[model samples]
Target: MKAILIEKPGDESCMKLGETAPPALTPGSVRIRNVACGVNRADLLQRQGFYPPPAGASPILGLECAGRIAEAAADVTSFRAGERVIALLPGGGYAEESVVDAGSVLRLPDALDFETGAGAIETLLTVFLNVFQLGGLPSGGTVLVHGGGSGIGTTTIDLVKRAGGRVVATVGSDEKARRCRELGADAVANYRSEDWVEVAKQATGGRGVDVVLDSIGGSYLDGNLRALAEDGRLVLIGLMGGAKAELPLGALLSRRLSVIGSTLRTRSPSAKAAIVTAFQARFGADFAAGRIRPVIHRVFPLAEAPEAHRMLKASTHFGKVVLRVRDDER
Candidate 1:
């Protein structure tokens, strides 16, 4: 089977396509003929040797994939061979084939194509867990998303609207702000311009937002706390800007606010399974009914993964960038 191997990673140039032995089937796992794989910032980080796959995980970079089941382990009962599915992986999605835990495998809705499915799992699950599960976005409440044009950002916008919540988002450019609005964000602000915290306040009529999803961790942390409403929750999902930051403990004590941080890839298998189960039961019908949709920004052939990495690093694309292993699959 063909796979993207990071041979002692230094850059995207370190990622090479080469033939390797197909992954052998294991109990409680299923082999997928990967039709498409989603590229993530973590993948880029892994390529540069900043992140490594967890224990017992494939050394490859991808975190999620969509495809048909080639084989199912003996314990797998709910899913079968030849079934079309998409799955969350701890690692090892950037390949022609992959073996995923049956518990993490989900049957894609009939209405969704493989390309969209490839793009769906990581961002949607990440946003859902942090924004709604942890941040507690109640119906009719206001939520603010930083990096509004990012994969997680755009997905959070849709999820917030679907849950009957309002969204205020910060993007780097006017074009991205427009994209956020198109995804049903109630208000958009340019983070590169004036203070987005002030803009968010005005958007919410000075009430501030109930929840905030922030990936920029350095200078934005204090500002994110400032932008939160009384008793609001702030969920930090990434440290894209930088890790070190001076936080205002007084603000949290005075406003009674909470700040939480999470990453999906580093989670335990049971925890991931639980998250997937919750999402499945909550949104399965909506997905099948064609209400919630995956937002795909672009699709590149599997061999051009380095270009995809470059594009992700450029931070210009909105939504997810997928690598199509089989064009006909979608």
Candidate 2:
């Protein structure tokens, strides 16, 4: 199988398309003839050697793909060969084929093409797990989302609106702020030019937000806290800003705030299975009916993964940049 091979960690030049042995099937997992792969920041981290695959998982970089079942174990009763599916993989999605746990695969919406299917699964699951499940954002509640023009940010805005909640988002530019508002954010703040903490506070009529979905940790920690409503939960999903931060213990205790952090990659299969089940049960119908849809920024062929990484690192694209492994599959 051909994949995005890294010859040197931390160098974009190291990312080249090369052939490697296809992954062998796990006991309970099924094989997917991968059609498209979703590009994520984590893939960049893995390429740079900052992040490694979980124990016993494939060393390949991709975390998700959209494809058809090429092989299935006899024990896999719910899915079978030729089934159209979206796979949430531990790794190995940047290839022609991948092995994924049967429980981790979801039925791809009938009308959704593989590129959109590839873009949809991971971002949907990530936002659903962090903002709604962990952060406890209620219907009609107000939420603050950082990196509002990002793939996760745009997905969060749409999900929040559908759940009867309002969103206040922070972006890097006035133009991106407008884009976020057009995507259903009740308010948008330009963090590059203003104090986002104060912006978030004023946006909610001084009450602050009920929940915060933040990927920018480190220095933004204090500002995130300041933007939170009393008893609000801040779910930290990434440390894009840096890992270290000064703690505001007094403010945390006085305001009864909760700080929670999570990453989907290292979690056990069973744990991810639970998250997947919850998501499918809750949103599967909407997906099938196209009530919720994917937001794709661009599509690149699988061999041009290096260019995709460069695009993402430069922060020039909004929503997800996808890799079409097989043009005919979609």
Candidate 3:
């Protein structure tokens, strides 16, 4: 099989299309002939040797893909060969095929194309797991989301609105702020030129929000706490802005705040399966009905994975950047 191979852990120039052995199918897993795959910031980190795949997992960079089941383990009864599906992978999605745990695969809705499926599954599961499950965002409650124009940010805004909650999104530019509002954010703040903590509090009448969905990590920790209402939860999912910070134990105790750190990549298969099940139960219908979808900023071919990485690194995109592995007729 041909894949985007990394000659070394470095810049985009290190990647190139090359041949490699196809992955062997494992029990309780399915082999997918990938049509498309989603590009994520984690991929870039992995390429630069900052992140490594978990033990016994594929060393490939992609985390999610959309495709058809080329084969399925006999124990997997819910899905069969030739079924359209999207899967959350531990790795190995940047290829012609990927073998994934059966429990992590979702049937791709007919309403969506392969590219959309590729783009939506990862971000949807990430946001659902962090903002709703871990953060415990109540219906009609308000949440402050940092990096509002990101794939996770846009997905969070859509999901929160559908769940009857409010969103205050913080973006780096005015255009991103406008897009966030159009995507259902109740309020949008240009973090580059505005005080996001103030905007978050003012959006909820100075009471602050019930949750703070943050990806910026350390640099935003103090501000995230200030943006949250009493008893609010701060769900940290990424470390885009460095990872070390001093915790103000006094404020945390006084405000009764909870801080949670989460990541989907290193989770056990069973744990990931549970998250997938919960996401399907809650939002599967919404996706099948075309009521919600991922916002795609661009799509590149499989061989151009290097270019995709460059674009994501530049942070100029508003949503997901996808790689088309093969043409989809339907």
Candidate 4:
């Protein structure tokens, strides 16, 4: 099988398309002949040696993929060979094939193509778990989303709107702010020029947002708290900025605020499966109905995984970047 291999932990130059042994099918899992895969920031961090795959996970670089099931273990009855599907993987998605736990697999909607399916599962599941499940965003609630042009940000805006909530997004440039607005964000703030905390408050009539979905970590911690309404929740999914920060205990106590940290990659298989099930139950119909879809910024051939990493690291893309594993006629 062809897979993206890293020669060392460094720059994009470290990655290369190379041949490797195919993964063995495991019980409770299904092997997929991957058609496309989604590239994520975690892949970059792993490439640079800052993040390592969890124990027993594939050392390969991708997090999500779309393809047809090649084989299913005896214990896995929900999927069968030749069925179209998308999977959230622990790793190994940057390849011609992937073997993943059956619980993490979902049938790809007829309305979507493989490229969109590759991009959708990870971002959609991430947002759904953090914003709605963990953050407890109520119906008609307003939430603040950082990195408005990112895959996670774009998905957050779309899901919040579809769920009868509003979004106030923070971006780094005017173009991203405009794009966020087009994606159903009720308000947008260019963090490079405007105070996003103020924008979040204003967008919610000065009461602040009910939830804040932030990935910036330390640098935005104080501001994220300020942007939230009383009893609001701040969900942190990434630490792109520095990791260490001091929490304002007084403010937290007085306002009854909550800070919750989450990551999908390091979770147990059962936990991940539960999240997948919840996401499917909540939004699967929306996908089939075309009410929500992944916003793909670019698609690269599997051989060009290095270039895909470069684009993601440069932070120029709006929404997900995908890798085409093969051209499936179906």
Regions more than 4 Å wrong, model 3: 328-330
State the TM-score for model 2.
0.97
Deviation (Å) of 185 in candidate 2: 0.8
Error of 2 at 160 (Å): 0.9
Put down candidate 3 lDDT per residue, 1-330, tens digits, no spaces: 878888789999998888899999989999999999999999999999999999988888899999999998888888999999999998999999999899899988888889988998889999999888999998899989888998999999999999999999999899999899899999999988999999988899999999998888999999999888999999998899989999999989999999999999999999999998898789878987878889999999999999999998888999999999876544
Full-model lDDT, candidate 1: 0.87
Model 1, residue 232: C-alpha shift (Å): 1.1
Against the hidden reference, what TM-scores do the models get?
0.97, 0.97, 0.98, 0.98
What does candidate 4's lDDT look like per residue over 124-188, in tens digits?
99999999999999989998989989999999999999999999999989999898988889999
Q: Report model 3's TM-score to 2 decimal places.
A: 0.98
Angstrom error at residue 100, model 3: 0.5
Poorest stretch of ten by lDDT in candidate 2 = 6-15
Better of 2 and 4 by lDDT: 4
lDDT of each: 0.87, 0.88, 0.91, 0.93
Task: Put down candidate 2 lDDT per residue, 1-330, tens digits, no spaces.
Answer: 888887678766777889999888877789999999999999988898999888988888899999999998877878889988998888999999999888788988888888888988889999999988998997799889988888899999988898889998988888888888888999888887888888888888898999999888997898899999999999998899999998889989999999999898787888888999998787778888877877789999998888999998998887899999987745
Using TM-score as the yardstick, the better of models 2 and 3 is 3
Question: Candidate 1: TM-score?
Answer: 0.97
For residue 129, give model 4's deviation from the true position in Å: 0.3
Please name the candidate that would achieve the greatest lDDT relative to the true structure.
4
How many clashing residue pairs appear in each of the predictions shown? 0, 0, 0, 0
Residue 308 in model 1: shift from native, Å? 0.4
